[model samples]
Target: MTVAIVGDIGGTHARFAVWRDNGLEQIEVLATADYSSPESALAAYCERAGLSLGAGSAVCLACAGPVSDGDFQFTNNHWRINRAAFCRALHIERLLLINDFAATALGVTLLEPNERLAVRAGHAQADRPVVVIGPGTGLGAANLLPKGAGEWQALPGEGGHVDLPIGSESEAELWLLLHRQFGAVQAEDVLSGAGLLALYAVVCQRNGQPAQHANAAQICAAALQGESLATNALEQFCVWLGRVAGNHALSLGARGGVYIVGGMVPKFADFFVRSGFAAAFADKGAMGDYLADVPVWLVTAPYPGLLGAGVALQQAG
Candidate 1:
């Protein structure tokens, strides 16, 4: 089957795949960190699949951070991509590079209704803009706007860097703690995986406890294993995430819904539903009612960005 090459590149990995006609098929993943450059990693993927670029197949790459002039400059990863390099290297007819969050926004429409775990049962229709966001290495945000019937345009945003408005006095204290360590705090200071650990450290310090330095994975593991401190931090992180997501929803007027897409949150789906997240989301004073009626969904599909890349390729083609 004739297919196009596509990828959703993250800091650590690039999900590589090809879509046959209009359906997704032959999906693979390569570690972006495994190769020093995106070109080398992409070459490995093509080689393993025995795929040649002479078909002049259009290449679509969805990457974390910003995309400009068909080039992707990832903030967290060292890879700097130029479309010309890939087009020449792969002998492709065309190349398209897009923001990963934008890819997620596009992918949401492709998700099955059941694929979404709804946090609030409200009026969610397809016409209104749908917001997509998640926390991994860092936070990513995007929104899908209706262009025409059954057609949408994904817009990437640097929502993660927005200032975190304090929700309560305790949260204000948390902000102060974060500010001491990192000047000019962004929402990512508390909403990301690393941000969760930072929250834990702040909590530990306040309680006169030894701050347990841990990574995102380690903290999440401890939380799942009934570690009270870790669990508390994770719970706090979830609430903050929900609050920020609600803020995003308000800004986007995303009455259609908010879709959470990331590797981190899906694993903590149960914990999220049972945590203070829902309450925090609706805690906005006057905006509380507005957000209370807007539903939130978590994207559970794997390799969503690759799927999004495929969708982008189809549209660009």
Candidate 2:
């Protein structure tokens, strides 16, 4: 019974669990701000869970940034980690650190039939390249290509940092407002949790009113309750999400599917389903027919990164 410790580390929270019997057990979530470093946080989680790492056990962490030369720096947080130090500290024989979205892309394939909700039913062919994009504390994107040998490859990219796409006149105005504040408005500028608050603020300013919410959560909550200002912001968020998702699809030729996964979208599933997401996704002018036939899926599986870490370890073996 060889079990591994799995982690999905993000800017706002860190998720930890033990992978056993192809599923996660003893799952725990911690606020990233509560710890000084990822090591301390891992130590705390292990201590609280009364778990120990054996000599041959593997440690896999799906991080929120690029992993280069066995080192990773958090994209939205301040924690930096070297794989050697982390492995030494944990006394583990194997370690795998990968981009969080890469993990999500791999995990998307492992999802159960009911774990996903199909947003657009397109003609998806088996084993074609697929894209996964999600927005949470930050935006994440990845592509999954099947290797045709019962294995798959996850390609990680920081597509979220691309320039924001303004679709409408109102959106252009909103972009101008955001640009004035942030200098260069990347997709992450309006596609992340902090971006939600920025959108709400800009929308409020556009309507000649003061921002009524102080944080992203507050604004989302207000929007969920059908508050006018927050609802406007939420709609704007979904519209932009559709535009960006379509762009990613076209760029990658991801006819297999486009999966949306994150901590944010599932919170407002109803609004997302009813919003202008589908229309905007298929509104690529001349390429509308091509995109209209591309399926869009919303991943609902919990602990997708943990599942992906297990997949990585299995593949390595």
| Structural similarity to truth (TM-score) of each candidate | 0.95, 0.96
Clashing pairs in 1: none
Instruction: Please provide, for model 2 over 1-317, each residue's C-alpha lDDT reduced to its tens digit, 9 standing for 90 to 100.
Output: 36888899999999988887777888999999999899889888888888764433888889999888756889889898987788778777777888899988888888898999888789886778898999999999999987897577999999899888888899999999999999999989889999999999999999999998998889989999999999999999999999999999988888888999999998888889889998888778899888878999888888788789878777777
For residues 194-300, what per-residue lDDT tens digits would candidate 1 score against the true structure?
78888999988877788665788888888888888888888889888888888898888898888887888888888887888778877889878877778887888
lDDT of each: 0.82, 0.88
TM-score, candidate number 2: 0.96
Clashing pairs in 2: none
